[model samples]
Target: MYSQEETLRSTIDKSLKVIRLYDWLLNLYVLDFFVDNHWTKLPLSWQECFQNITPQDLGNILSEVPTKHVLPLSFISLIKAVKSLSLPRDKISNKNKIGLLLSEDICNGHPRLKNLFLKHVKLKKRHEICLMSKVVSGVAVESKCDAVVDFGSGLGHLVRVLAYNNNLYAAGIECQSQLTEEARSVQLVHAYRAALERILVDYDPKLKHAPVRNIKHSDTMTFQQYSTQALSRLNIPLPACFARGEADLRQWRRVVTLYTLRLALAPLVETVILLDRVLYILEHGLSCEIHPVFDPKLSPRNHIIVGKRL
Candidate 1:
């Protein structure tokens, strides 16, 4: 129920908290805790510091991605906020939300797009794509741009909603070719299924009661062929760039260049990015709004940075 604006503001505050915590922890001789050194091998003070990590404290920090073996950003904030006189040195927190968007909110969006979501996506994915679509759509509307490029369009969820639901001309740029192909498959499947439904709806009344065993079986066999021929079978474009290679993440300066070249003169052109694993990116002459994008209880990493090219 949190407004996107509020989410932006609160999450920005939280992101700063995380940045502060990281800075604070670095000077505490906690760098040993960051490296390969074992707990027993660390200095006694370090051991005591970690030993203070209680079950409750652990719970608080665990809210970040545990699977990555990295400390949760919120936990970082928690550590800084609770720094003791017994141990000193540190500062920073860039509140970032961490979780997939949910389904119920998105499925109720565009009806046909919802069908694609329901048919092709998992629950977590459904939510993520749906929520992402909303965020991008809002920005796209304000930015007045028809083209959308999703940086790491994993599995094409965000791209799916963007292209089909939001009616944006979307292109998903992914590093992995296999995922790009898989996303194309999902897109083809939806198109094929939609084609079949149209046929069913147009079926003659005289044949309406005819056995659907063939129809059902045909659906099963269609995917087995998995042909590029599917393109000829329908007008629905596969929302992907099949042969597109990995992007040069090392060259971040291009983001600013892009804004200067295209977005600078526009009143509301914007730069939007997932502020995880990297700090927020900004172009000069632009304004940013940071928001807590998700229900915090579900994901502490829910902060988003929406920077308008003013």
Candidate 2:
């Protein structure tokens, strides 16, 4: 395992190189896909490379979120370029050194509080809160922290878990008043439900179980449908190239290929950001570590930046 300094230096070097190498791809706005004829920017060889790729193949690029993909022999050099520049997003185990310190087994949340607080949370969010609450609580306990302050505390899910489940004093700071109000509203529901449980012995079946199914775009969704849903969510209008009925299939394949390439670069970007934070802590003579506490496929931003002044 490399030391933190070694890891940080290596990551920064690679990140800079990657950003410089793909500066054009990185800077081009998705909104300008058709307006600027982004497809025309690709070299003819690159365009021809993606010509025969099918929509299902394009969907596979997204659905798998590939740690590794089987590339054609012809594209071996392309794979080499990406692999050499991209930081590996390998599943981190306790045996591996992500930071100087090792992570412990996450303590389970309080069962009663879990029932009260987890109703509105989605599956991915539930997974995150369940794991992250324990990690944050463990850090607070280790540092003998008087209170936990959560920044960007959307709906206060983690804060609630830390405060109620872990028996820690926790407060959430949210820049949006709507979310703050909603969190208060949710807190009341928890209080009311807890009161009901004591007085009426109420049982909520929904709280006990949640059903989940893995859906793949390649299996169930058409490429157009997938692209439409993605852009609609982001409030981006369909690019004119795609909006036309005779949209080139080659352009669609290129869009998927380029998007997957960007996704592959994400870990390098995250490493740069998290390490910068770690360096700031180290510079101040404080202890800091980044723990990969969540499943990366489920929570892409899985690394938790942990620091303590003591």
**How do the residues 1-310 of candidate 2 rate in per-residue lDDT, one tens digit apiece?**
9977667777777667756666666676443353355666755665665556665665565344452445554344544545565434454666333332123222244555545575677767877777777677787778887588889998888887677667888899888777534432212112111222221111233322121122234455544464454334333343442434234333555555655555655555666777777877877888787777766767777777787786
Error of 2 at 230 (Å): 16
How big is the positional error of residue 119 in model 2, measured in Å on the Cα after superposition?
A: 1.6
Question: Which segments of candidate 2 are over 4 A away from where they belong?
Answer: 1-3, 55-114, 180-251
Sequence-dependent TM-score of model 1: 0.41
Error of 2 at 244 (Å): 5.7
Clashing pairs in 2: none
Error of 1 at 276 (Å): 11
RMSD of each: 21.9, 15.2
Q: Against the hidden reference, what TM-scores do the models get?
A: 0.41, 0.64
